[model samples]
Target: MYKHLVVAVDGSATSLNALQHACSLAEMSNAKITLVHVANPSEYMAMAPEFMHHASYEEAAVAQGNEVLDFAEKAVQEAGLSDVVKHLLVANKGARDMAQELVDYADEQGAELLVLGTHGRSGLMHLLMGSFAETVMRQSHLPLLVIRSQKDEDE
Candidate 1:
C-alpha cells in the first residue's frame, strides 16, 4: 500500500475534504503523510509583476503561506495524524507551473502518492480559466487521488 503520501491543500472546502480523506487513508495504511500547501506563485506575480526581480514578493508569499500552512497543520493535528509529516511550500513566481511544482514537491519529499481536490470546472470555463488540480492530474508522476468538488450547500 501507499507508504508515503503527499496531500496538496488550499484551504478550500474541497481541499479540506481531501485532507480528511487523506488522513483516513494514511491511518488505514499506516503510511507517512506530508501535508503541503503550495502558495500559488501567480498570486504574488499578479499582484506585483515588477517586484519579481526582488525577494519581497516571494517573502510575502511564503509568510502568507505559513499562515495557511499553520491552519492546515492544526487541522491534521486535530485529526490525530500520527505518522504524517507536513511540508509547507511557498513557490515564487517563475518557480514552476502548478503541476510541475506539485510533482517536484512530491518527488523531493519522496511521496509515493498524491491526494488533492478538484474544482470540477470543465467545458469552456475550464478551457478559459484552467485549474491547478487539472494540471497536476495531467502531469503528476505518482498515483493521485482526486476529490471532486461538492456544490455549495445553499446551491
Candidate 2:
C-alpha cells in the first residue's frame, strides 16, 4: 500500500532482482519508484596510483554510476513501470558511506519503503566485505524489503 518506494541499485545481479521485486510491488500499488545509485569516490581512490590518474578515478566512478542508473531505469521501464525516478548519489570524498547516502535520500524523498538486494555472504566474506543492505536496514526509518540473490547450489 506504499506510495513511494526507493530502490538501491549497484549494477549487480542481486540489485536487479531487487528491482524486479520493486517493479512488481509498484505495479500492484501504483506507486512511484526511485532508483538510487551511490558513487563512492573513495572506492576509486583505493586503486593503485600507477594504474590510473587520481582525477580520472573519480570521473570513472561517476561514469559507472550513471551507467548503472541508466541500466536500472531501462529495466524498470521494460517492466512496464513508468512512474520511475533515478538518482545518482555521489559520496563526497569519503564523507559518508553508500548506505548512509541511500538512507538519507530515502528520508528526503519521503519514501514509505526502501528496497535492496543482498548477496547473502557469510563468515569471512561477509565480515571482510561487509553488507550495505544490512547497514541500510539498521539506518533507515522506513520499511525495508530485501531481495536476496538466487544462488545455485552446485557452485
Candidate 3:
C-alpha cells in the first residue's frame, strides 16, 4: 500500500542495500520512489575559507549529493522503475540534524514509507558517530523500513 516511498542514501554499501530493497518494494507496490541525500550544514561550515576558492562548500556538497542520487536513480532505473524523484538537501535551517531534515522532507513529500540502512555501530562508536537510522526511527511518525548492516550478515 505504499504510494510514495523515500529512500535515504549516502553512498555507503549499507545505503545501497537499502536502495535496492526500496526499489524492489516500489516495483512490487507500484509506488513512486524519492531518493534523498542530506548534507550537514556543520560540515560545510567546517570548511575553511580557502576551501571555497573554486566552489562553495554548499555547492560542493550538493554536487556530491547529486552524484549519490544519480547512482541511486540509475539503480532504480535498472530495476525497471521509471517513477523516481531525487532531492539534494543541504541542511541550513538553524540546527543541522540530518534525521530531522530527512523526516521533514519525507513529510513534505507525503511519503508513505521511508527506508534507510543502519551501519550497526554500537557502544562508543555509535556514541561518537551517532546513528542516522536510529534517530530517524525515534523521531519519524511515518512507516520506516531499516535494512540492517552488511556486517549483520556475518554475525
Candidate 4:
C-alpha cells in the first residue's frame, strides 16, 4: 500500500483523469495524496523571447504556478480526497525539465507513488513540445501510474 501518492495535474482532461485515479488509489490504500503543478520555464520562454523582462515568460510562470495549484486543490476537494495536499512547484528557476522538477518534489515530500495523465500526442506535436508524462516515467524512481485518454486506451 502506498503511504503517499503524488499526482501531477496540468488542467487537461487527462490530468483530471489522473487526479481521479490518484484519489481512488489513495482511498484504497488509505494514503495521502499530494497534487503538484509544474510551471514549465520552456513554455514561458517560448511564449516570450525577452527572458530578462520582469513581465516576460519567467515571471508569468511563477504566478501561473499558484493558479495551477489552486486548480489541483479544487480537483482534490471535488474528488472527495480528504487526506490530500496541493503543492505548487515553480520549475522555472534552474530546472532542467518539468518532469525532473516533479520527481524532485516527490522526493522532497517523501511520496511513494507518482501518477500522471497522458495526452497521447505523437509525431510532430510530440517531437516539438515533448511529453510531460513520458518525462515523469523516465525520471521517477518510484512506482508510476499513467492514465491515457479513453480513446487511446480503447485503441
TM-score of each: 0.82, 0.90, 0.88, 0.81
TM-score pick, better of 1 and 2: 2
Off by over 4 Å in 3: 44-54, 93-96, 152-155
Which residue ranges in model 2 land beyond 4 Å of their true spot? 48-54, 92-96, 153-155
Per-residue lDDT of candidate 3, residues 10-103 (tens digit):
8888899999999989989999999999975456766778776436667777877888999999999999999999998778653237888999
What order do candidates take by TM-score, descending? 2, 3, 1, 4
The global C-alpha lDDT for each of the candidates, from Candidate 1 onward, is: 0.77, 0.88, 0.87, 0.79
- lDDT of each residue in 1-155, candidate 2, tens digit only: 99999999999988999999999999999999999998987787777878764368768788889999999999999999999999988886442377889999999999999999988889998888787888888888889999988885213
Best by TM-score: 2
True-structure lDDT of candidate 1: 0.77
Ranking by lDDT: 2, 3, 4, 1
Query: How many steric overlaps does candidate 2 have?
Result: 0
Cα RMSD for candidates in order: 3.6, 2.4, 2.8, 3.7
List the pairs of residues colliding in candidate 1: none
Query: Which scores higher on TM-score, 1 or 3?
Result: 3
List of clashing residue pairs for candidate 4: none
What C-alpha lDDT, on a 0 to 100 scale, does residue 91 get in candidate 3? 80
Query: Could you tally the backbone clashes for each prediction?
Result: 0, 0, 0, 0
* True-structure lDDT of candidate 2: 0.88
Native-referenced Cα lDDT, model 4: 0.79
